[model samples]
Target chain A: MERPPHFICIQLPANPEYVLIVRLAVSGLANRLDFPYEEIEDIKLAVSEACNSIIAGSPPGSLILVECDSDGKTFEILVKTQSVDENDGALVPGSEQDMGLHIIRALMDDMEYLAKPGSGAVIRIRKNMSA
Target chain B: MDIKVDKRKVEEGLGIVDILGEIDVYTSSWVKEAIAEFIKEGNYNIIINLEGVRYIDSTGLGVLIGALKRVKEHEGSISLICTNPQIKKIFNITGLSKIFAIYKSEEEALAAHKEG
Candidate 1:
């Protein structure tokens, strides 16, 4: 039998000021998981980039939800935001948003993107302890 | 959460911008504005000292890229001094290491500036 994953979640206004809070929270969680210093930095950067993309693409007053879970061997992060304007959340090629996505992809072991019919954009990233 | 950007002249035409603290979405604007001010004052060759920076995100990297473009228009260049392994890793992973000149110390960056 597998043990249950540890979970942590944060919800904040889609404001840039709150990004630090999210980063700190994720850092603390990763530290508790005993992630190496380098991997912890990578996780922090990936999460920050996700938040930046969501905040930039979402509509005003939008809220960002970040969820993290770890099972000692694997760590996962999910960032979600709701947007009324689909086009507003679309990633423009060669834009900063595109670059941000590239950075996240390079740092994380795996990354997936989803656009729910009415829920908006979601970015899921994962890291393996041994990777 | 907070950042401090200080600008000083290295020579008649060269200046250095020293940044301390974290550079994220919220604090990157301050860095951008400080670099813009340096360009406005006709200083082109600039060295950005990031030794004191503990964290920088893609937004912070974007600010550096933008500043590089603005300075390049004046035939100026932007060199970076970063010693932190984590910060250096970000530049390498993003392939920005190839685009910008990075040095481990201010002295080396200054020598390179003088050589040009």
Candidate 2:
């Protein structure tokens, strides 16, 4: 049987404080899932790093959408920001100049980048909950 | 997130700090300050309680390592009470769990301190 989807989207303000908001939400969700304290923290940091990536863009917009899904065993976090398919060197993920890329990679099980169908940049973070 | 630091008298003059909060980039300074403040006060027996903190990052790990360095310079002591596996992984990844004494609980850390 296919798993039920557990998803939620948070409209974040383009600000650093929003990082804290994402942290709090992820922490709470992790807690509800009975995630180990340390794993919960890991999730929290992953979410924060993702949000920070968007925050670095400092795009002139409100609401950086964060979609989350959990299957009681793994958690998938997606942060969609205002951007189209423009690899502006400054925003490239694997560049030596970007700190967020390294942090996100180190903290999560898997990280994927996708340009929105119409517009924007979306980063997805997936992690195993029981691992 | 909230961080409250505690200071207590120790037989060997070890400094201890109670860390309460998510230890991410946004809040790691709170831990850094606790250790820095202790070092400045000339105390080195440090035992950080992670029973309260659920999240930690490399920045957070780096800060802990920094504190450990400061304590080592003065021949001081630093330990950790990590109840969460996630925080434990960070320490393990950074090889800090080997350098710093990590206990299962605050009581165990304090007991080990007494034996040392």
Native contacts conserved, per model: 0.87, 0.22
lDDT values for all models: 0.85, 0.71
Q: Write the per-residue lDDT of candidate 1 for residues A70-117, one digit (tens) a residue.
A: 877789998878443334445323233477788898899998765543
Chain A TM-score of each model, in the order shown?
0.80, 0.76
Candidate 2: lDDT of B113?
81
lDDT per residue for candidate 2 within A1-131, as digits (tens), equals 55455666688776765577778887787787778776676677778877766555545664577878887777888786744433443434433234455667777899976543223466788888774
Which candidate has the top score in lDDT? 1
CA error at residue A103 for candidate 2, angstroms: 6.8
| True-structure lDDT of candidate 2 | 0.71
How far in Å is the alpha carbon of A58 misplaced in model 1?
1.3
**Candidate 1 local lDDT, B1-116, one digit each (tens):** 38999899977879999999999999999889889998899888899999999999888999999999998998999999998999998899889999999998999999998899
Candidate 1 backbone collisions, by pair:
none
